[model samples]
Target: MLKRVERPVLKDIKDACVLMKDAAFPAPFDSRLEFSCSARGFWNIVHTGMLIPEIHQVYVCAQGCLRGVVLTAAEMNAIDRFSNIIIRENNILEGNNEDLIVEGMGEILSKLPYTPKAVLVYTSCIHHFIGCDLNLVYRRLREKYPDIEFTDCYMNPIMRKSGVTPDQLMRKQLYSLLDKQELDKKSVNIIGNNFATDDSSELVKIIRENGFTLREVPRTKTYKEYKDMGKAAINITYNPVAIEGGIYLENKLNQKHLYLPLSYGFDEIEKNLDILCENLGVQKIDFTENKKMATEAIINAKNIIGNTPIAIDYTLTIRPASLAKLLLQHGFNVVSLYVDSFIADEEDDVKWLKENYPDIKVYSTMHVKMRFVDRHSEQKILALGQKAAYFTGSNNFVNVVESGGMYGFDGIVKLCDLMIDAFLNEKDAKKLIQYKGLGCENYDTNCK
Candidate 1:
């Protein structure tokens, strides 16, 4: 036999990133086997779907698929609102797959202590393989329980290879229960947010003070209130994942749509806020005081942290490129960006980084090569997100994901404060980043 060939595990910092100028949009790295980073900072479909009040989830998948979601509900202490129907091999051979879903749902509902306003019927990849008639399943369920509405959701991991991501699809499906409502011209609902926008943020303050009602899912107390989202005069989406859902509601309900993603850059913040003010027919916000406060906070953090090599990741803020630019402009030594792909909204920011800071490297979060990279290092690196903290071996890191709903000038100030605190403090990075869906309290005993 020929000599056995051995593939060497990658071990270099330079290998982790590309020069910013060479980075590509959507997909920067060539397709190959992927290595998953253990930073489950972003919320999954289960966490998102549960945001709706008085809604139940019934996952019709193999037991293996059910484990992850079941644990999520258990951890949140909401197992009472959750149910499942295990899809066995016999169902694929002799048993009717559609009937399993229709009948299983009926059994689940009849057992519940109280009737849910709606049910999220989730199917797995096995359903797709068997060519299950989902429309038939939904029709039968609707006919059987005319009072209880049904929304179709997915748990298919196979879809990861292509098309709209499960995250995007689940977000769109969240608003499926909303029906036509008499318009509320003074009311606005921020769509597809797992967290409410900060009360102190310019957007919230301006909207509330300007005689406009802002509705957020996290603040909705009842099922009727959640349905009233359809009556909003404006639909605002700041999260990139929620953009599709916002546009969906805009067209279907004839509400004005605004997608102002949380930005650290002052100019972008101003431009977005100005647009919002114009649409809502409110006076323009004065950001002079806000900008001054944010600038002071950044200066204070920079002085404390000095030129410590800073790393940013997409998990914290979807626009890592923009946040990196903000730090660089404020005189921070940003070393690498942990990004899998660039979002469409950050095109200009990407180009700016490419032209001005070519040496600022871009790294793929899921590249197979990342698995072999040395994680333990002596150097003190400051990581801006959980993924960056894990990959950089930085105990000193700001651990916020999805920017922690920090928005506008107040957001920038809050970011600086977090950075300062992170720099001054050291925590066990390994233990901290391992928790899935940060900001939500998880219980080991499930509130027994």
Candidate 2:
């Protein structure tokens, strides 16, 4: 007779039971059993890679791991631009790993109907484990395809725990194809954004007002135009994740770079705008009307939803902590926040929340028990992001991710509008979140 083994209880949201005051500065519940949501889909590596114009991606990885990227490409209706090579058990066991990547990529290029300006060869963790000669592989590819640009990309998840993330590296790699060009003083390039800056955005409006040509990678459709990014007078990176990419541009091309990250706080936004104008050497446009509009919008939303507990989720932006502090300052009841870590920019905001709002719960959405999150709230609670909406089990949520093309003081006003609309109506979260990318025009989902 065999003895029965009892299952151990997995530590989760209920077990950790975190609150704001008790939490640390950066990571809260850093190491814990995580539960991933089925609807948890944002702009992933596949989508990120597609931003470059006239570039084909060939990923060499296991079949199981390839499914997500394959589907992502298919969903985007861009299967033609994507290819993958399956890594077999024998290939790993046997030697000659270097030949696998070089030869495999060669075959993919031969099958293509048209020539691409560049090819991103994505090698997997298996290659790293076997110590595959990546240098030899890229050198061989470059030698063979002298006319075509051969760029190295990595799909290694092991590096996620240390150093720069795979996503950060991917963004950096995209700009590597840019060769040095004569500077175009009136033109500027903004890097590391999947979505184009909205025309209505104050950032875009201000740049145009200053008589400058603003170029973003996503908006480029031609290979020449994409390469022309190297010639820009200034390279601006607004997202924190893309800071390294910005630095790479400045170092390699000697192009002036500015990091104007978005913010929820009024003071930060004003300071960022001033810095941007000063760098551009343009007179600062008066933001009196913009500030007035944002102020009015904030007041209107607060008046409508008085004392309604709001739950903040990381899906909205990287600055969820800052957003929570901003809302709390404005008298909006923010009771819960769901995130893994806080960035350096939010140090003050995190401290403010922890000290001032000690009772506010800080829950880990990744915790295994988050799947069993309490859906019932005594009052009608408002959720800010999709994950927050799903976890809180609230139908009323502002369905936007990755900033939703919102920037500058206009973004503040637009956010308030979203809050007001979310409070007034209900959305089918199950149906809406079914689409992978929020602003991404991909996905053939009928519900979308």
Those runs of model 2 whose alpha carbons end farther than 4 Å from true positions after fitting are: 1-12, 376-378, 441-448
Q: Candidate 1 residues 1-448, lDDT tens each?
A: 7998664557673544688888887667776678898887678888888888888999999998888899878767778989999988899897599989988998999999999999998888998898999999999999999999998999988877688788888988889888877889999998877777899999898889999889988777778888988889899998888888888888888888898887878999999999999999988877899889989988988999999999999988988888888888889999899998888888888888888888987888888788767676798999999999988889999988887778899998898899888889998888988877776646322111
TM-score to native of every candidate shown:
0.94, 0.93
For residues 194-296, what per-residue lDDT tens digits would candidate 2 score against the true structure? 6776778788887788999888887787878889899888888888888888999999998888988878888888888888788888988788888889888
Return the lDDT, model 1, position 393.
Answer: 87
Error of 2 at 48 (Å): 0.5
Location of the lowest summed lDDT over 10 successive residues in candidate 2: 439-448
Pull out the clashing pairs in model 2: none
